[model samples]
Target: MTVFILVGGVFTGADVWRETAARLAAAGREAHAVPLTAIDAGRPAVGHVDLETHIADVTAAIDAVGEGPGREIVLVGHDYGIHPALGAADRRPQRVDRVVYLDCGMPRDGVPPLAAVPDPALRARLAARAGRGETQGELAPPATHEEWQRWGSTAGVGVAALDRLTALAAPQPLGTLLQPLRLSEAVAAVPATGVLCTRNGVGIDLVQRLVDFGDPVAAALAGPRVTFFELPTGHWPMLSCPAELADVLLRAAAGAGHRLRPADTGTPPAHLRPFPLDVPEVPRDRKGHVDLYVPGEGGARPAVVFVHGGPVPAAARPTPRDWPTLVGYARLAAAEGVVGATLDHRLHDVADYERAAADVTAAVELVRADPRVDADRIALWFFSGGGLLAAPWLAEPPAWLRCLAASYPVLEPPPGWGLGDSRFRPVRAVAHAGALPVVLLRAGREAPGIAATVEAFVAAAKDSGARLELVDVPHGHHGFETLDPAEETGPPLRHAMRAVVTRLTG
Candidate 1:
């Protein structure tokens, strides 16, 4: 397929392209991460900062990549890297697949890298920081993540580079910034993908709004040459939410939908609340409230409460992109004679993965407060990322919740980061399992890191007094039931969910 020459910017490395590269490699494509600004960490950094030189470097890199047999190249720019990336793309539009911008869209020509074209918040953040001397400020010592600490200490690069940059860097020749490079020709010929990281609090809806604001510029792009995908995370998501960040980048490159949660848990267990016309929660989670399919024909069945996942506190939404078909879980539970009620947990401020394991405790409380649910037999069935949120409670969940189940769960720092498995390292969540039985499920051909995370969790939980079961299934992928049409179009695929529910409530 097409090749990608990634142009990383100042203050960031090529790390953002890691996951995308890996996925492309896996899919049999070529990708290269081109690093720049080797502008010395010490003084003389000013002399090294040259836009024209950087542009030449990109053109050179493309020529090198194309050496023997040339393939289409997409020169991607991130942050300030756009100045050079766009310039190179303009000089050699024939070789460029598309000049795709991440977070920062196409900046108008003649304006400095610091100029404002669209996205008011981004402009404001940059202006405030630059004004406060972030660019010209003295080089401060670097404090970085533990893993990177050693490398950073050795490299001795951090904030000081900014000071060096400001003191000696060239005043970007104004023409490049002010001139809107003619995209109508190349935009129509080349394919481009715009990855808007929602990590900045900009979701799909917000992305649409921003696009509407830039409609004039967009119309000039010419034809269906560009695409956009929102990664709901942060500005520096590669550092904060790397695994999720990687997933998003891969989705953009592959032209595929992000993974979704599974739906329809076969015949719901008997202990679920029947689909109630009157509804249960009545007010706060009106759109999200559902009946519990209680098991057995008894007056008071051990009711199961369902809690879905959001980044932190679960806000109930009428259009839950993942589990709309959770309705099937309830229908099955009702038929089985159990009460099944799904709820939204209480984490609102959390924006990253560290709180993933910790949020389970709060979810337990929300599920327990329910009147229809039986405190003794409550069970948790979570999917994909939900499993990360659910893992903490597996060891000794509340007295009410009796079982824990998760499918295609992410266990820790994830593979691309190679921080190893954190799922088994029970710190804050160790005390949670008051003796809840746990189940961890995985599709046979899962990505390497997830498999490792699950294995680590199994090993860690081995002697924790909690029962653990690993179910390796025949069909599915991450969030397969939710994202894959094969699973959603038919009834056979719901069998896996039924299998988990059967063990939990039957």
Candidate 2:
């Protein structure tokens, strides 16, 4: 028989797991919910409760269960709860047979939950309160239903359940989030299961894609001992789908979830696969920081500078310039009687957008300076995460800049990304776009979080009355240029390119 221990997130108590525990007990399984030092008992002694207090609470739960032969224990952690669960498991590695990371990012050692707080305003306020010598500091729970979504997707949670969740909410200890989780090498041997919640923006497919993209952390998760399961609901599976969640927890304890394969870096990832286009290949000028594809028959032609998206890992092979999508777009532009350019920008991390923007500016200058390029007739095209780089160009379009285009762009940073800068928010910046032509290609099947950003940008653009031309690829994914087949993605891809070209020359 497997015993399960559940740890709830900030602002939650053991009471939050009542339904799930009952379901588990009905299935003849033992279940325990750890009430953290400050969270379950209401908002008293706020600063007195740090991460160690909660870790101790979990350790005590483990002790009560006790370790013996033929006994198995599964520790489940959700959101902020994962920290203490990991800390306790690190201390009692022999007791915990498996650790379930429920609907949360993989927390790393020495990184506090404060670092991953999704809301910018809340994160800033928390930082201010914690940075001060406020011994009584605590974060109040969301008072409204809409505010609850800031923590995670609340889909499938009914009005009554949400009201109960809000009414029972307790202020979280500031210290709990401030302190980091410490782990030892011994815990690495414990098998792990990840329960992904699709509505909260993370799913198994995205994880596998990240692994395929050469992310070291994602690679580590692809190890044999790590398995995955996906719930088609929101973040709080306990409240939204308790029975299903209980069933998943049981299967996870038995190590019956989906296993991920290691990324084969040798083969190009799906996003980097040959762009779904059959354009004639044009010779690329590989000598400069920008790869330029000059038209075969024209001189001083309009140029379109294609900016590839990513906080792509610094270690990712074959760089953006070599990606088939960018290469294909540039060659296709050259084939259409225009100069096309692509560059390798250093957007190697979530926090490097400013630096990436600088790289883009320099690349555009390099492209405009080329002898065969008509500097006054140039368009800037951005893709993927590179979409944020379009902010400055959108906010204040230059006389020489003719048009701006983005394909499946991330117009706004998702809350979890911790991007607090206002300069990178295109949704906010598009209001200042004036009459500059804007072409946006949206992916219908984009990741939920990213799709939200796109929709917000479109709404903002429409409200501002910007010269926006929108194209929807009803069946396309995020990197649709390479992810979807040509028949599905080609029309929009060429149409967006043509729009930019028309703005440049017409």
What C-alpha lDDT do the candidate models reach, one value each? 0.48, 0.86
Q: On residues 1-506, what C-alpha lDDT tens digit does candidate 2 reach at each position?
A: 78899999879999889999999899988999988787776424534788888999999999999667767899999989999999999999988999999998778888878876876667778778767855355788889998787788787899999998999889887888888778888778999999998767667877886787788877988899999999978879999999999999988988889887678747667866888889987888974668999878657999999999887878777787988888999998987889999999999866678789999999988888878999999999999888988999998889889999999898986544555445888999999999899999989999876788899999999999999999889999988887788899999888888888889889
lDDT for 336 in candidate 2 is: 80
Model 1 Cα shift for residue 325 (angstroms): 4.0
- Candidate 1: tens digits of C-alpha lDDT, residues 164-220: 323433323222223333323443455666665542322333233222223344443
Best by lDDT: 2
Candidate 2 has what TM-score?
0.86
Candidate 1 local Cα displacement, residue 447, angstroms:
3.2
RMSD, every candidate, angstroms: 11.6, 3.4
lDDT, model 2: 0.86
